[model samples]
Target chain A: MMESDINWNSIYEILTGPALWFTFIFFVGGLLIRLAFLFRLSRKKDRVIYNHFSLAWGLRSIFQWMIPWASASMRQQPVFSIVAFIFHLSLLAVPLFLSAHIVLWEEAFGVRLWSMPDGLSDGLTLIFIAAALFLIARRRIRPEVRILTSAWDYALLGITMLPFITGFLAYHQWGPYEVLLILHILFSQILLILIPTTKLGHMVLFFLTRAFIGFEMGGRRGARSW
Target chain B: MTSPTKKKFEFENNTDAPVDVDRVRAILNANDGARIRTWLSICSRCGLCAESCFVYVANDRDPRLSPAYKFSHTLGEMYRRKGKVDRAFLEKCYQIAWLQCTMCKRCSMYCPFGIDVATMIAVARSVCHSQGITPKQLAFFSDHCDKTGNHMGIPVEELVDTCEWMVEEVEDDYEGVTIPIDQPDAKYMYTVNPREPVYYPQDISYAAIIFAAAKESWTMPTFGWDCTNLPMFAGNRTLAGKQVKNVYDKAQELKAQHILITECGHAYRSMAFEGPYMAGYPDGKPPVKIKHYVQLLHEYLRDGRIQIDSDKKIKEPITYQDPCNVSRNGGLWEQARKIIPYIAEDFRDMAPNREHNHCCGGGGGIMPMGPDYKPYRMASGKLKADQIKATGAKFVITPCHNCFDQINDLSEEYDLGVKALSFKEIIVEAMIVPDHLKLECEK
Candidate 1:
């Protein structure tokens, strides 16, 4: 038992130290490089977009979409819209403000943002897990979504959900707690690496694309795209 | 409304011509720019775009017909394969790009990422175009536009003769009405779809009468009078640019303040919006200002250039079919809405009107795709038919010829007993002529 505990501790330390830092650098640096490359390419080949880039229109388009049910499209598919909002909000919030994650941030960088209370964090994590399951079920059962889904899409969903699952299990002290804690850290790092590299890159690319469409539809033509 | 007889196109399939794989690669490489690259990279396949597509809904929500699948299986596959795709693959891509989707851009609005699947479909069509695999009817019109300045191959003599003929028809209603041609320093250099001269010359007479009532100076360019760019719909960017440049040059030569486009949606979009980009203008704008007919009519009503007879206004329930290009892409939605109250007493809007309205299923040159696609076109138009039916409107006013024809066809096919009228038709029917411009017999 002592030896097993020591092994888990070393693994946890490694995941929380160099692995976490490496993942952070890769996530930020890689996305920045990719974004810069794409932005430059856009200016070079599609300079028409730049000639009519209106900040007011772009922000209006983005802002309208950010609000729940602000768009006709959102209203058309209310169930999916609500679930997506919840999923994305929880996805961003849990990682940034969960009390446990805040502890890591304070220890590593001597900085911390406001943290969610333990009860609220627990509630949000359950909602996140439910939303993830709903998304998976949607892909599995919804014919339109299923047809668009490939093995890679399902795998990405699994990768995204595993860290949260493992973390929840660890917090509840269910099963091998140390192993679950180490897996939660490792799975999260893996997700960070995959985000800037795979379809998960949409997390950042969505803003650019939304802004481009806004500029094209609204700025150039004076139509509200959202 | 008479349908133009389907012409037998020479290069319908062009199967004998060897598939130009190298040309396909070149075109794909050129079109795979930053916008397309980012769009392809970011599509999460959420399938939220599925429900927004009228075609998918009309076809009973088939997953295969979903916009996400349409773009992904075509352009996404080509990009994944690095444009080394074969003729059979190109044939499949052509089916999905041309037959399955209308590139109406409705899907883009629903996308959380704002993925312009229509743009991807257009790029897919362009790739197919390189391999000589375009819809034959569209290809025929495109070739005509490339060779002659008009899609129907109407020569300058025919257009001038049509203008003269339309002037005679209009003079019966308004004594001094004339369809002016190449009148220099005209405030508006007007343009029309080639179909106006070919099948619906009455459209010309209505415009002439409207201008006479408004006391506005407008002239049609005899050289580049055809404003519609069917070549752009065929994915022939070179021909599209050339066609737009023809109109632009004519407007510039005439020194017109605004190049007023007739009541055509795609023509307005091509001339005002996409054409300049395709023509590679530095500012991405036409040399002269481009105006749609809706905007002009709205201005005419607002400025009291023409008076509407309140008693002559149609009292039947009316609904408007918002052309995707004109309303959504061209930013003229409110202009049409403003015009409605002037001409109709009872106007009922469709459930999802304005920019969110479904395509009448004839956009992107689908109306010209000919008899081969009629059954599918009618089927896909089911969503629009239902939208119109729900409003229970007797008259459907759409300013676009494409929508006019499709809605008329839908009315007939669905037995909805509705009349599809262009705004020009409605306005001409209801507007009162000034006594000074009235004919002797009428006065």
Candidate 2:
């Protein structure tokens, strides 16, 4: 090989090797997971046509209908609602588009979507970590919601943010390199498995329910879709 | 009256009391797990509902008084311990679920999230029903209703005798009006709360006067004649089911098209909703059609079946108290308001009216339970008094038995100098004469 063959990029080694193995496991594991989800769904009773369509649309609609900063409706104060709301929205925006997720996606399927720039990713990551921390603090603090909440629920939430935090650290190459990377992968794997099991399943289903509820209200009920 | 054979009139000790802890545990465990989503999923905990609740407003806004919290106290514990909760814990659950709250849906209307507090209470009551741990007061009245076939415990013979007496009284006054029972092929089967046959038998005459003026084919069945379903308040679904089933059986036996429940809150709720669901669509057949008497009369007046001779000649201003069960739960608040002016001339509007109107503190078997529940009753009824005072009405016209009981108590206890009047009482004052219409000739 010529001197030019010595590609000085450590990223080359990551892209060609370790990232590849991590991603192959993710794909096979993710497919197995989604297959189990399909099996579970198949056993449930048939959904009405509206449900099917709304749910399909609702799956992709978290960012589709962006409102101008969620103005407060007369009967509903969407302010506190917006707090948990942003915490969720940040979860979608930050981790799903982090540089690591892009790398994993490319390795898994040889497909690529735009990843956020490093500065934007870090800024959003910090904001998201802060928002999630705020939510955890609320569940620990607010008496009413606190009564309904359990420590297991808080632990589950804490476990969920671990992957994002660690992956962000991995991207920054902060702290012990191998340990943070392993923690990131382990937490991400746990989140992927736990997604459909808990009330956190509402994280996926609430969109569909909310959208359908909105459409039902707007189309037939004549109430404004909030 | 078939002489009201003594065999037909004895009260059974349905208590099965000295309750079996094991059986009670199994039933509680089963019911607590059955309707999980109805209790847990429906509540979104937006505190807007706090303002409309009688218990919350009356109890210094302790979160416990919030109907939502009452549910959490009971159902939450049942969930926490995974339904292996103790009988002692359940006894308290029974008290709060049955006594502390009136199963009113006023809060549901205010709930921006549409968390139905009444549905929660009803489900909680369904649990209590399984436990046989209902309030002693509700239990007593329900036992009396089940055994004697009427909450007032009027013997079957005495009930028939009173009906016959009303027939005689109506004849002497209107000339040829007949109050027939078990009349085959009648279009409507009318029932009143046992309140009439026992004490205010005059109200029966008022009803008779209305029916006769309209010349409708109606009947009252003496076999299973009472209409008010008491087991509903007691949270005794078995008895409620039997009572409602008996109504359908009697109606079917008489070949009646529709049976009308009296102006009793629990009665209408049980017969109109619970009964149908309990014995609904047997073998996929259509459920029996039942209507509340208030709504039935509202339609009667609305469609010109009955005409008022005068806006009841009373001079005092009257404010209407909407029974929470009837107005909010039954969706008949407007219909109730529509019928009031037909019976009584002077009706002044009250504040926080319609579906938002306060409970009259008598429902959930509170009144018949007597005074043990009076403290909770007085505490919860302050909003009602405030609304009444705002109306400055001399009389409060409520078209429900429980509301009537509560309103009477509040009026006397508060010394508001206001009289509590039922629609029957007010309509009796305003009903036109059949003799004047030349409609009767039996004398």
Candidate 3:
């Protein structure tokens, strides 16, 4: 079909309907399966008992290390931490608060929420792009990180940044508006599909990994991992 | 300084050794649980864990020695290969998991993702052990423990003789004191690292002095007297389980209410924490209470069971080395800090004290790797040596025996002019025995 003759309604329906649900199912279901597998594996015959168990301590570690200046990792690598903090903050904020995302959520679940100003959303998207560039540059320049940088690591970074880039272009109508919108939806969908399977799984696994270490260090070892 | 008396075996250069890819794969497959999978998938290669590792830092930030790199290359590679690795690669895995890394868990403390890199390395060691590709010394020590119930292979007669010798020394210094051995119905059964009797017999004497001063009813069993478990470090889980089970059974047979592990970090961690788990006990809880001597010393001081003559203090500045096992892993940092000030007038804290302290490079059974690996091991302890040097302390007190040995080596190698002493030794030097318990000549 010609680009102008394409039926936009059907495409939007497919993108928001079966495709969205599929991504959600795969992301959530795959996560649950992985978590269950980890729990089962931990139940081996010979298990070391951690004498101390403090839910408060574990939770404290989670929040304590979440801040930019709260952890030694952040202090040791300030530039990376700043970029990473902004990247993660924008990654979460721009998606959840953008007017378009709020509209989608309202339509899907019949819930209305506050939306971020378009200017703020645009600025966050720009920061996200800049952070992604810095991370890529770091991977290329820093010898230690350079050695560990694999093809998949670069691909994950590219895949994650694509949606934001396309979404920004579409919002400003800088590129072909119709094509950019379609590409944004497609890229986001690809990310969702890859979330549980690839390094993108960090999005879900971060909490579990942090909690495990926190509980281990706080309750059992009587110290914080941070 | 001193070289290990045992001759080194040339395992790494022996390329003719057979490779058991199937057995390696089986072990890898068995260990491919959620923990390993999550860690492998989640690490973002941030390189933050490098600073936390003494080996990585001491090696001038070499990426190859970083905890992340070590795990990714060895365990991560094994997973990628599905354990169908060649003999040469397995040998490299042995070096990375066993020799290079001390499995100190300090990296876990600094990891943003909180990944337990040490556990991953231990899993790699387990795979190596299955393939008969372990360090010769570690394997020999494991075999010794399996055959003779102690790493040193001290016969019961020799063990009794050593105890009598220690008892005689203690009696010569102080009256009305005894080293009770094989005494049933004691409140606590005290255990020692085999090296104590073999190389540092004075450690036994120091412990005897403390027990006598406290007037505690404790026994040292002839069987299962050694608490150090080489199998734990070698990642021989079955053998580790057997070793722990032997100690537990001995404690049960003697009807001791508690098992007091000496100033050995890994021994305390293995017995009180890992042992019960290895022996199929739920939550790793032993049949009886497991206590470290540091904890006991702290308690004894608090309860007035033992008195430290704060007046009789060390003349020079002193600092404490937090054992990775006892402080970071066992949460006994505060106890040592609390007990040190009472004994030393010039107690100074290491800048990154407590859980963040560097490993002494003697952990993970690296000490038993012998002289062939000593230069490398001592080199990896550069950060620790620097930390000690910066403190400018004349004495470095560490509660763990492995730390004691490693710190002593670091002191001698770096020419820091410091003496390494265990907490028990410090206590004996500074403790005040009552006149009633003192011998007439000494009084």
Q: Could you give candidate 1's per-residue lDDT for residues B1-443 as a string of tens digits? A: 01122443223575756677678778778877778888888788899899899989998888999998999999999989887888778877877887678888988888888888988898888888877788888888988988888899999988899889988776655788888889999999999998999999999998988888888999989877888988888988889999999999999999999898999989998998888988778788789899899999999999998889999999999999999989888888899999999999999999787878889989888898887678778889999999999999999999898999999999999998899888888888888878878778878
Candidate 3 off by > 4 Å: A1-10, A37-54, B1-9, B12-17, B441-443
What local lDDT does model 2 show for residue B192? 76
Clashing pairs in 1: none
- Rank list by lDDT: 1, 3, 2
- Shift in Å, residue B192, candidate 3: 0.3
Q: Which stretches of candidate 2 lie over 4 Å from their true place?
A: A1-195, A201-226, B1-22, B28-34, B37-52, B79-85, B106-132, B171-173, B280-286, B309-318, B340-353, B415-417, B431-443
DockQ of 1: 0.71
Residue B21 lDDT in candidate 3: 82
* Model 3: DockQ score: 0.62
lDDT of 2 by residue, B1-443 (tens): 01112221111223434545455456455443212332354344434455567777766665556666677778666666555655566666766775677777565444433344564565556555565566666677788877877777778678778888988876656755677878988988887788777768887877777677778788877865677776776667678777777777888888889887766777766676556545543332215577777777788789877666774466778888888667665667778888876765677988667755678766766566666567667777776877787788898887787787777778777777788787765665676654543434532
Each model's interface RMSD (Å)?
A: 1.2, 7.5, 2.3
Superposed on the true chain A, the predicted chain A of model 3 yields a TM-score of 0.91
Which of candidates 1 and 2 reaches a greater lDDT? 1
lDDT of 3 by residue, A102-149 (tens): 988998778988999999999999999999999999999887788888
How do the residues B119-196 of candidate 3 rate in per-residue lDDT, one tens digit apiece? 899889888777777787788888889999898888999989998898887776787777889899998899999998
What DockQ do the predictions score, one after another? 0.71, 0.10, 0.62
